[model samples]
Target: MEALDFAAESLDAIWSEGAIYNIGFERGVSEWRRFIKPDGILAVSELTWLTERRPADLDTHWREHYVEVDTASAKLALLERQGYAPLGYFVLPRRCWLDGYYRPLQQRFAAFLQAHGNSPAAEAIVEERRHEIELYERYGQYFGYGFYIARKCHYG
Candidate 1:
């Protein structure tokens, strides 16, 4: 995907949510750093390991799905390495999974299946999602969307 080539040292901050992985955590933070003014903030939410150790299945799942998935400390260190000073961090709440995303998505499954003609492919996709939700429900303590907020350490 094409990245926006913003004017250097023009922005006060850059915020990204659940999307930076489209390019990659390191690449996104590094490339975007040049656009921020002195001490400007860079905030992003990324798939992160809540703990260094996790169950084999959960570990395997994330590794397979997002190879860049790592602990929050690692993410923060990566930010620091990219010239950002850590300011704050938090995991997206459980409701962000249940009440916000999965519940709403589950509500659409039937219609989605219907629209897709209930084909095996569509069903398989739904099943995979269900499996993911189940895994989260069981091992949420090990992984989640980690919100990282930091400021640029370099001045223009």
Candidate 2:
């Protein structure tokens, strides 16, 4: 994989939406912190457990797929530990996923299945996506995307 290059302390702001989970949350924040100037900003949207108690199935699904999922308060604590001050956070509305992402993706998946004659491998991938969407639909009250805003601290 090709590496990304960014000068240390060069960025005024770094924004990651939905993709940070791929590298793991804390690791992503820690790695990107070095690229942001002191007093700069970092904004990230992460999958978060909204309720104190989540259903076992929901918990298991995320534990298997996104082991780093946690609460908003936990993320705020993490920000402070990483030398950033928590600014604010908001839960992204359900439409943001259903309309903005999964709906369009479902359409694309349908087209792919049609064009590819619904091969087993491709159908399995589509089914997995469908299952994820269903989980969000059913358990949306327990979890959601949280948009976190923080500023890098200047320790002068």
Candidate 3:
């Protein structure tokens, strides 16, 4: 994989859309800040845990991605240091499990095959569905995903 200079390109893209605000949730909040104007709005969907637990298979993916998965507290602390403030946080851990994500997609793909018949496109869809199931089964050991919201503090 090649790394593009995302920040440089983002800074260079000049366009007007009236009070532009950058919004991204999950995983790359640190990098997303670089693309926004210092005084511009930063709004994001965020996830927080009112409670914590030892997630299953954390070590495998953690080593693979080299991500220091921060708790909600640590994420807020890091945002504060960067002059961003937490705006809102909520925990809506799906009461269901990975089957919730997987089963629907599987059903959709099967329906697609029935509708489309055995074309190459249909076969590709089947393959993709199989891959998704394998990936979710392997990696989605944890039963929930969290959401978060934050804003860039106005310093002026």
Name the best candidate (by TM-score): 2
TM-score of each: 0.92, 0.94, 0.46
Among the numbered candidates, top lDDT falls to: 1
Whole-model Cα lDDT of every candidate shown, in order: 0.92, 0.91, 0.50
**Candidate 2 residues 45-147, lDDT tens each?**
9999998799999999998999889999999999999999999999999999899998999889979998889999889989999999999999999999999
Q: How well does candidate 2 score on lDDT at residue 67?
A: 88
Query: Worst ten-residue run, lDDT, model 2?
Result: 1-10
C-alpha RMSD in Å of predicted model 2 compared with the true structure: 1.6
Shift of residue 117 alpha carbon in model 3, Å = 14
Report the number of clashing residue pairs per model. Answer: 0, 0, 7
Question: Per-residue lDDT for 19-57 in model 1, tens only?
Answer: 999998999999999899988999999999999889999
How would the candidate models be sorted by lDDT, starting from the highest? 1, 2, 3
Report the CA-based lDDT of candidate 2 relative to the real structure. Answer: 0.91
